[model samples]
Target: MKYFGTDGIRGEYGGEHVNEAFFEGLGAAVSAHLQGKIKGRLPKIAIAGDTRFSSEPLKAAFCKGLRGVEVADFGVVPTPALAFGVLKEKADFGVMITASHNPYTDNGIKFFDENARKASDEAQEQIEKFFDEKISGSGAEASVKKVDMKSHYIAKMGSILPKGCLKGLKIALDCANGATAGISGEVLRGYGAEVVEIGISPDGKNINCNIGSEHPEALARLVKDSGAFIGLAHDGDGDRLVVCDENANKIAGECVMGLIAIEASRQNALKGGAIVTTIQSNVGMDESLKKRGVEVFRSGVGDRLVMRLMLEKGCEIGGENSGHYIFMDISPCGDGLAAAVKLLSTLLCLKIKVSEMSGVVSLYPSIQKALKVARKTPISETPTLSKTVEKIEREMSGNGRVLIRYSGTENKIRLLVEGKDSALNEKSMAELVKSVENDLQ
Candidate 1:
């Protein structure tokens, strides 16, 4: 009886959880769950992955499970391309092998629906159930085969580029040398930009070593030196994008939200004139959108939540401070390449400069720290942490915010604080985190 985490199956790169046996079950279960519908036609599946070493094995295992099911293997592809392929080929579903921005040692599987959105909770449960009871005993004869992931993905992304000219734009792109190294540069070319692409070469080991959304300082420095209009960085799976403006100043994800929301609203793409983000977003972002007469909607931190609110409110654009932007106008799931294109297009049309929007959302000075703790520890499960957090929230009322949550994939408790006063928030955060750690230990 294997347990599935919040998203999908995940664990160490080569850990027991992601082994061949699990893959075979996962494949067969997913296939069987979808078999009833496929009776009307051949069930089509698409698969892609980041540069993680576990990619091939997992892909192989998944394919093995889909014994009679048809699958198109888009090798070493990004998350967005997997969605594009599914919708382009009109397949039943798509699977992506990635841990997003997690360290290289960790990996995961992301599922996308037939409409190119992240899979729903019900679907995820079904997949896990299948993994719990695998159908095939032998994966060697699995009928899954390979397809040209690059060519199809490129064409699909290219079709979405805004019809215009980016002739004067000089952009530096850091692909994290993971999944996006291939599509980002070529697609920007289709839009007529002068693109200087770095980290496009993936060695499988350097997926997000020191680049991408998790760290854009390097990209910012390069953008300043290169004198490009903007520097774009993506996480390992290509689901999130962080930007650096012309002056080499890093633009946080939430700020980009204000920028994209403003432009989308101006362009009449902001349906219901609303933008969605997690509760952890900067106060400046919500305030900025309100000033522009657009609504700021709050959701849980997961992209799944942001997407749900987007669909519910029909929001044209929504994203996270983590750099994952889910543009409902494009697709339900976050697409780093799509966000890049949309942002670049909007900036070009505005003609003011990326630096201008830099001042749009002023993030509250905040800090997030985590300590490795046992998943079964009292601190995480005990009511004491919640009680302390509530007290902190009340004490810092109208001054700061506090958030405590367990990582869906890791054995750690995260402490997050955001406030208008940096010093106060910093001290408060430190004191609280330390107390929790000490008590738990």
Candidate 2:
């Protein structure tokens, strides 16, 4: 809770808190914590990183502090690959160095337990406590071995869909010049799709620069110009995805999940006939799924919380609105490439193009505002804002909803209001933004 954010520990690379010394200390503390948690057994950690100039040095420094631990180094891989490698290698856990959609100057570290899922909050707290205690080690005798998971990950994803499932289909991919720069194309092509690649040339600083899921406009244009059947984009870590239909219409992850829920319902594959998503997801998804005899459950704003609820609620699909779709039927964590493959497979199976399928779910009007705050005062501590939120919810009376929370990675508070009536929703959102500023100021 102290060091980890909604997803992981992220900050500007080379900053005082993110530099080599800090990571080295983190490495020692995490190794100690994991060792204890795993019953005094020697923890075998699978460490992987994305394409950032600072990643390699940080990883080396972190591993340096591991001392005598067995570290399997997966050189330059996606975050999901690191998660999958944890299971594939049967390691005690996994560590990934990436900042997801953050800018190139920023970097992060995410941990996955042996189950190939995000480390539990309690586990993260334990690691943080050890870090604060400043565990000491000789920084020597750490066993760092290199392992290649690219091909293995590719094979596993391909096995999910039928053989030659994407034959004769064309898809465009923007890999964000990060983890999936060269890997996504290889995997998609291996699955028989004609792949057009962009953002594949990573020069360290170019990762996530005007490309990837955060910026899908360029990818949309490419998809339309190249006449590709669909376009998919991934963030820096290749853990989240943004897609474009054949008509260059951008599709949010909520809509993607809705469409998938429909398909799953048709095949009687919807686990417990429910879908899990985040509070940030659109209300339209809820209404659409309800019509299809599926229920939608909301979790906190991270894939970790989504997955946590999925397990608890017996739901098979869960994801955030920021293109982090978790097809629990396939992968444990949010995987851009895996989701794209499944989307393609769905398209082929239904004999429909992305453009035609995009209309399956209509998103309601939603507005989001991010207000700068000097500090992250807990919502409960701000009685005025908390009460206002409750009052607004009462006014909505189940017609819509509101979510206000401080961002885990940024010094700001986000306010989201959604409903069927666009005009009323906008007015309500403006009032909520004012309340956030007043309360947090």
TM-score for each predicted model, relative to the true structure: 0.92, 0.93
Off by over 4 Å in 1: 135-142, 161-164, 376-384
Highest lDDT against the true fold, candidate = 2
Q: Per-residue lDDT of 1-441 in model 1, one digit per residue for the tens?
A: 145564566787668776776666777777777775567656778889899777878788777667556787888888887887888778888888888888788887878788888788888776666666554322234456677868877876777765447777889999887898878988888878888878888877788888887888879877977889889999998989988888888777887888878887887877888888988687778777788888989998778888888889888788788788887667668889889888887777777778788676666788888777755454445656656776777877788788777666677777788888778787778777766766554
lDDT of 2 by residue, 144-192 (tens): 8999987788778767777666788889899999999888898788778
C-alpha RMSD of candidate 1:
2.6
Give residue 297's lDDT in candidate 2 (0 to 100). 94
